[model samples]
Target: MFRRLRSPGTARALTWAAALVLIAGIVAFVTVRLGQEDKGPANVGSVPTGFASEDFDPNATITEPKESDVPQAARVAAGEFVLAAVGRENLPKAWKLADPGLKRDCACTYKEWLTGNIPVQYFPTKGLRGASFSVDEVTPGHVVLQVLLTPAASSSLKPTAFYIGLKQRGKDAPWLVDYWAPVDVIAVPASPQG
Candidate 1:
């Protein structure tokens, strides 16, 4: 026979504690699932879930233009991001190019892009600033360019570097950013829990 519900006693406290444990377990499960779902190192063709894209080719050979090919502004932007990544740019500088809503998130983004990706995605970071735009498929204000970065040495390896797909909101709605300027990757050495 089932016992009557406890009105007020150790039984009630125990019940509440058990409920909390159950909730914590559920949360932990969901967190683990999401962590596992991340696209292990972005490629040209593949994409992270909850995000969608149609133009990125995981295997396409994309490269930043020569030192003479990159423009003045792009180089500047890349420099700011690099400084921000290396702990030089203050909050305001990092937020210079960041969307208003993403200001607080720029720190992490700056580090990864500056360290592993931007140096390759944008010629400016490669110490090749002021390169002319030889093959700009879309202008900065209207393109979400997805650069497939690969080390020339690892010719056969999958894209080991980051391929940032810029998403600007405006008349273009979401331009595939060919311009290399955004920090799509944030380095979280300890806070990867999220």
Candidate 2:
């Protein structure tokens, strides 16, 4: 400390060395940041508890075939029609066919449906394909139909079955969906904690 650098060039060289070290540190920080991995969006099926949205529109414009306008064959085959709509990815159509009580039971709104809250009890994200419908039980005004969903692949596995209940007001009244409970329940994924 006692003997300072006598030459001006020596002092300038020392300052340049300090500056170079600072610049190297900045470059190394940027390189590390750029090399880090990036995580994509969150999983599709889950929503956090107490999650509220002012923009949630429960009344989505879902068109349904009028009972009077529908043909006799289509009117009788409620399970088949709903399964067909779901298979085609016509969510709006299938939504219209669901019982209002089912929606209430799930505590789901149209906005939730838009975000993948399906009406079915259990929905397999993969292996959804062919579906068949059969009448399970028939009563005076109530009928239960079984819908067997066959995966596009997975021939070795047995087809999954979902039961839907329908009711008619009177002898000549049109059938309306009254019950839709999934035999298999899909669990909601937990929200991540910060």
Candidate 3:
């Protein structure tokens, strides 16, 4: 005859062990999930500590201010402002330098003027340099400036030119750029006889 089974103590111990194991597993899973959330996504690039935002613009062109040959103060200011704007790649500043009438005449907003209107060659970021900024012509309330865009040492491309026209209401009024255009250079073909 077999004795009746009566090991309640053993049964209780087994139950406790199972419960502890489950609790440990749950704790481990919660800790892991919380750690992952703290870390955010792995694919996101981490920015280096102590980064300066001023150095963010890689295309910025640095130039030293030299005495301008432009005689009129307004013309000189216009030329310098334009050069600085293009070199610094600050389209907003360039837009602010434009007269309100000029904006209307161009039928463009500041962003549109920057993204669609201005030529890449006029940007100093294109390594354009060796320029001669001059007041080519002057009228009562308007002035024209010639910018000779020569390739810098890093560039071997052909030189281009631009004329920027500035206007002001009067001599005492602030000068603003009203128009700008690239001067066309006709490329001559090589002779067949040669």
Ranking by TM-score: 3, 2, 1
The weakest ten consecutive residues by lDDT in model 3 span 185-194
Model 1 C-alpha lDDT versus the unseen true structure: 0.39
User: lDDT tens digits, residues 19-51, model 3?
Assistant: 999999999999977876775532123321234
lDDT of candidate 1 over 58-162, digit per residue (tens): 576644324444344444554454334222334345445444334333334655533332222222122222212222223334322233333234233233233
Q: Candidate 2, residues 82-194: lDDT per residue as tens digits? A: 54333434456555665566557658777675444555543332455776665555545556666677765753445666667776657776566666655565342221110
Ranking by lDDT: 3, 2, 1
lDDT of 3 at 176: 78
Number of the top lDDT candidate: 3
Give Cα distance to truth, residue 5, candidate 1, Å: 42
- What TM-score number comes out for model 2? 0.43
Better of 1 and 3 by lDDT: 3
Question: What is each predicted model's overall lDDT from 0 to 1?
Answer: 0.39, 0.53, 0.59
Ten consecutive residues with minimal summed lDDT in candidate 2?
Answer: 39-48
For residue 105, model 1's alpha carbon misses the true position, in angstroms, by 7.3
Q: Count clashes in each candidate, considering only residues at least 3 apart in sequence or on different chains.
A: 19, 1, 0
lDDT of 3 at 23: 100
